[model samples]
Target: MIYRIAMHNLSNPSDAEDIVQEVSLALLTKCPDDKDDIAVKHWLIRVTINKCKSFHRQFWQRKRESIDDYLHLEAPHQRGVMDEVLELPKKERNIIYLYYYERYSIRDIAEILHINANTVSSHLQRARKKLKSILTEGGTYHD
Candidate 1:
């Protein structure tokens, strides 16, 4: 699950491993003793995703001297079109990662994110359009 989240976010193996460990520790510490089996699992997954988002935010908040240097240094080694896909807005990026990388159905994503399925679908649509545009345009090409 952590692997999937990391891959979907930026395809960074180390980041994914870190998230997995973070999530595991969080579960160990924060998991409610009285929660049911399903609830425990759900809580773990939710926290895992939040951790991935946190990691992304932290990475983006760095004080790099040059944008190009930052991109070159921070870009994760991912599969085809990863750079393009991540160029989409954060909401779109999260929706796509949840659906594709995490293998969550629309309903599952909605439940996980506490949003409606329609909203999830809308984000997915927008993400797809943004991704297609990025790829067709041959990358966002930020300098």
Candidate 2:
């Protein structure tokens, strides 16, 4: 799950692996105080996202091509859809991943992302509309 989220965010297998390793180190060093399983999951997610965002700020990120050379979905069309998803703005992309792939409710997504439930809902709605329009029209995806 962590690797998938990292892959979704970074779009590069190497970078995603780096993120997973960094998150693992964090887990070893700074484990969350809460013993609740849900809280730990959320903490790891938060840590992973923070690491990905920090990675984006590095100067090298601008020079690297955003490509997933390692991921080959079972269906050819899944790759196309994933490419479109990768093109989405980061916030909407994360929201979409959480809502759909993670099977998270809007309220749960809101809590996980530390945003208002309405904001999460709005993001989800807009992301859906954008995906629908882009996908239904053709394979063309615009930034």
Candidate 3:
């Protein structure tokens, strides 16, 4: 569950951990006495996504630093590719994260993101092109 959430959100391990903790707490508060495990899981996932969105909102409100800084500081060699990925428009970012990270099919990604499958595919195509160009320039993949 943690892996899926992290992948779908492109969240750092630390942030994922924090969100998971928040989800756990929220579940305890919100779940009814007779809620089944399946319902609990669904609620947790929804809460987790909400928490991630909230976190991003707060993070962006503070200041406008280079996204590259996050990439480099977190992982230098991988930073180049990550910088480009992070630079994508939010919709593209969400689509890529859902498809690649979460290992979701295009249909599933579209459902989760509440968009058409074709839109998800288009975003992915553009994201791939942008990532390829950005990484080719000064990415860690340079040999």
Candidate 4:
């Protein structure tokens, strides 16, 4: 799960692997002993997001490229609707991945992301709208 989030955020496999390793080390050295499974998962996700944000900033400091160029570098199998999902704004992509792929409730997503539940809902709605448009235009995805 952490790897997927990092991959989606960084769009680079090596960076994602590094983040997973960093997060795992942090978890091993600092994770609270009393936290339950759900809490641990939430903590891991939050940490992964922070690391991804830091990496993204560093990447921008190094260079810039068109979205099209980045897309071209994506794994060959991430085509069609998956590609469109990858094209989403970071926040929306996170929400969509958690809500649909991870099956996280809006409230759960809110707590994990440290945002209001209504905000999570709003992000989901907007993401769905954008995905609907993209998929429909290509006739590649449907309800």
Candidate 5:
């Protein structure tokens, strides 16, 4: 789960691997043994998200480069949709990835992301509209 969240945020497998390692180390050193499994998972996810955000901030401060160059390599045909998703703003992209790929409910996503449920729904709606427009413009949207 940590790796998936890192991949969705960072787009690079190597960066995602680094995030997973960092999260694992943090968990090992900081996590309380008394916490339940679910609580531990949530703590891990929160840490991973924070790490990804910090990484992005640091990278932007240093390089000001676009994330496109770091995107995961996929087949040519599938790249279009993936690219469209990647082109979304960070909040929308994270919402879409959590709602769809991670199969998380809006309330769950809100809790995980530390946002309101309505905010999550709004982001999801806007992201879907943006994706639809992009896909339709590319003549790839069927419905």
Candidate 6:
């Protein structure tokens, strides 16, 4: 899950794997042991987001990496939709992934992304429109 999130945002498999490693290390050394299942998942999602944000702002971002890594993480059937989702800007992409793929509610997405619920809603709507247009252009969308 973390890898998928990182890959979508970074567009590089190696960097996504790096994110997964960092998150795993943090979970081992820093995550609270008392948290429940859902709480742990949220914690992971937050840490992954922070790591990806940090990654984007750092010097290491200059190195070229490939999307080849993404091919194995997702099922064959999901590849098409995921390719379209990757067209979205990072914010909307994250929201879309969390909402549809991770099955989080709008409120949960708001909390996860540290924005208001209304903002999340607006982004989701906008992202849906953009994805629809992209899919329609590809001749895959239907009413």
Q: Which candidate gets the maximum TM-score versus the true structure?
A: 2
Question: Over the stretch 1-143, how does candidate 4's per-residue lDDT look in tens digits?
Answer: 99889867876666777899999998999889899998999999999998888886674434433334444546655555566787788888898888777889898899999999999988888888888765355443222
- For each candidate in turn, the TM-score is 0.61, 0.85, 0.57, 0.78, 0.74, 0.81
> lDDT per residue, candidate 3, 1-143, as tens digits?
74346434653655656677777777778767686875565455556666777878665434434544442354575665665666787677766665665567787666655679899889988887887665356434311
- Measured by lDDT, the strongest candidate is 6
Q: Clashing pairs in model 4?
A: none
Misplaced by over 4 Å in model 6 are 68-80, 133-143
> For model 5, how does the per-residue alpha-carbon lDDT over 1-143 read when each residue is reduced to its tens digit?
88878866777767788889999999999888998987787788778888989987664434333445555456554556666877788788877777766677888888988999999989988998988754355454211
Error of 5 at 64 (Å): 10
- Provide the overall lDDT of each model, using Cα atoms, as 2-decimal numbers: 0.66, 0.81, 0.63, 0.79, 0.76, 0.82
* Tens digit per residue, CA lDDT, model 1, 45-131: 678767777886784533323223323344444333666675676567777776765567888878877889999989887777766
Off by over 4 Å in 3: 1-18, 30-46, 56-75, 133-143
Name the TM-score of candidate 2. Answer: 0.85
Deviation of model 2 at 58, angstroms:
1.8
Q: Model 2: clashing residue pairs?
A: none
The digit string of per-residue lDDT tens for model 6 on 1-143 reads 99889987887887888999999999999999999999999999989988999998897576764454446645665666667788788889898789876878899988877899999989888998978754355554221
lDDT of 6: 0.82
| Count of backbone collisions within predicted model 5 | 0
- What is the Å distance of residue 92 in model 4 from its true position? 0.7
Model 1 misses residue 81 by how many Å?
A: 2.3
Candidate order by decreasing lDDT: 6, 2, 4, 5, 1, 3
